[model samples]
Target: MMRYIGSKAATLPAIQSIIETHASGATSLCDPFAGICTVARHFKRLGMRVETGDLLWGSYMFQLATIALNEMPTFDRLTPTLELEASNESCAAILSAAQKVLAWLERSPGRPGFVTAGFSDAEGSGRRFFTQENAARIDAVRVQIAKWRDDGLIDMLEEAYLLACLLDAADRVANTAGTYMAHLKSWSRKALKPLQLRAIPIVNNHAQNCCSRTDARETAKTNVDVLYLDPPYNTRDYSFYYHLPETLVLWDGATPTGKSGVPATRRHQISDFCVRRRASSALDELLGQSSAKFVVIHYAADGLIRHDEILDMLNGRGKAQFADLKVRSYNSRVREADIKAHHRIYWCDSH
Candidate 1:
């Protein structure tokens, strides 16, 4: 959740009410620009088959944990491979297995590797996103997870769940104001605490779901009953701001370099919707190609793209309506003052 921006969890009630008003009968939903998969999880819980994706690996991990999973994986198939006892209850069994992994991580000594060198002060890196001790723990856990999967000890679903746990734990204790764009000059209270993994509430849904990691524009051709859109509200590139999470998820075996001491990535991946000039055109193009019976888009009223521009784009295709909703978005190190923000909920019947 550290890499989250414009998440729809806060505005779920208002957005869901509007969605039911127009798309109550929809059995299939697609969230093309799914940030943290809050929309997809909502529809999935309602028994709708949902497909969602984002370009970042961190978001995809969220998708794997929240949307891709149809039921809680108990690691029953791998219990022979793993030395943990399984309980009869499905959820309890899964947690036991996860706790087994966490226990190993807790006992293991911290390894000074990618995370320690890149994101922490282990090697005297200027970045202080994590302390030397915490960074080493992260590195040890991440490396062990990778080794477990590579050694055929865990399957894809189990790996994703465990990684999500690790990332979630790290995010809470990270020494940043909110994002990993820049570390705080001094460590915060949370950063000083020892690292620990809490159980991610396993959301078990019955409907079969799928997800992708690609440009939202590319998914417009795929038709669905309801399509949810949550694009970037400004020109701030996520690849640059949340590069640490992306790298952590990737585990590319690449070390940190350069003055910033961050991993290598295409940091210039700013979306067209984030740009002032191209935003209007991009919204029009995405909405224009959508073949859903209904489309729901969440854009900030004070975002780079104006509320009227979003309305015009949606109205061009069919009947459009909006709801004014207030929410608290992430406050960046530079943009800390403007923490409280509002979004215009735009829903349309494209058919």
Candidate 2:
């Protein structure tokens, strides 16, 4: 099953192999920072109970949808209704809203101006690329979806999946760079561009699973056989990188406040991921509270977290051994480039 959470999902087979080698009868697996629930879903497929936690709302939704599959309402029955009414309403509302925003942008000055912007010259009088009209339509659909969710017509998981789909679709039509922070240098001279949204089947065959939205450091006391730690490598807060989509889905129409209140610029910011003094304390707290028999932490060589420091912290708590693996080359949307030779996958075991 495709999971919306977890990085280094490509490395899961190796991680699973190690788990099989060390703990054959492990009844449960937990991922503290389960992004897309990739690891949790893999274990769930093998009949092991899975528990996941993430502070981010979107990540929490992904974990709940992926791991808590048993609780989901049957998609077969719901799909037709969703497709005809909810999905259409949502898409239409998004489009309407986006068009409204685009019109506002045309009248606005500075970078927000559209009539005088370079994008005005795209094929088909800019509709071939992206028109203020399309943007409003996208926003209109999203607004409708939000309203439906608020009215209890859709559950959280369903709403989440729908929002994810909309986000993916909007990304295709967005006249911005790969991320929403930057405008596209050239607009697409096309209409009804390709939409790429991952759809979750209404009928999920995966085993029963559950997820919680809480701090990992606090949730480690549950009884489990394996505790998997994949904390943020440096301080790259996912909130900022994916804020555009989040803002759209989670938008209350309230003005943003402080630093996070404003939209980010094209230039990437790296301040959050930098090593901080509190990092050690947080790690120690998590290690101390985990009720699992063994702990496996995934770390990267280029992160603010030092391998020696992590090893020392784990060793101080219980019996520990460290294993390392090289990460395959991968492109990062936030980093906007391919990371060369990023050494990753640290397996720290506590027996």
- Considering every candidate listed, which one attains the maximal TM-score? 1
All candidates: TM-score: 0.89, 0.70
User: Model 2 over residues 229-348: C-alpha lDDT tens digits?
Assistant: 877766655666555555665554533333223333323233222346566677777878986877777777766677778878877757566566765443334432344445555454
Give the per-residue lDDT of model 1 (tens digit) for 181-258: 777888999999988876566566666677788778876657689888888888887777677777878887656666
Off by over 4 Å in 2: 1-6, 75-134, 171-184, 187-192, 196-198, 201-208, 254-275, 328-338
Measured on C-alpha atoms, candidate 2 has an lDDT of 0.57
Give the residue spans of candidate 1 off by over 4 A.
Answer: 1-3, 76-78, 81-95, 257-260, 264-268, 333-338
Candidate 1 has an lDDT of 0.77
Question: All candidates' lDDT scores?
Answer: 0.77, 0.57
Q: What is the C-alpha RMSD of each candidate to the true structure, in Å?
A: 3.2, 8.5
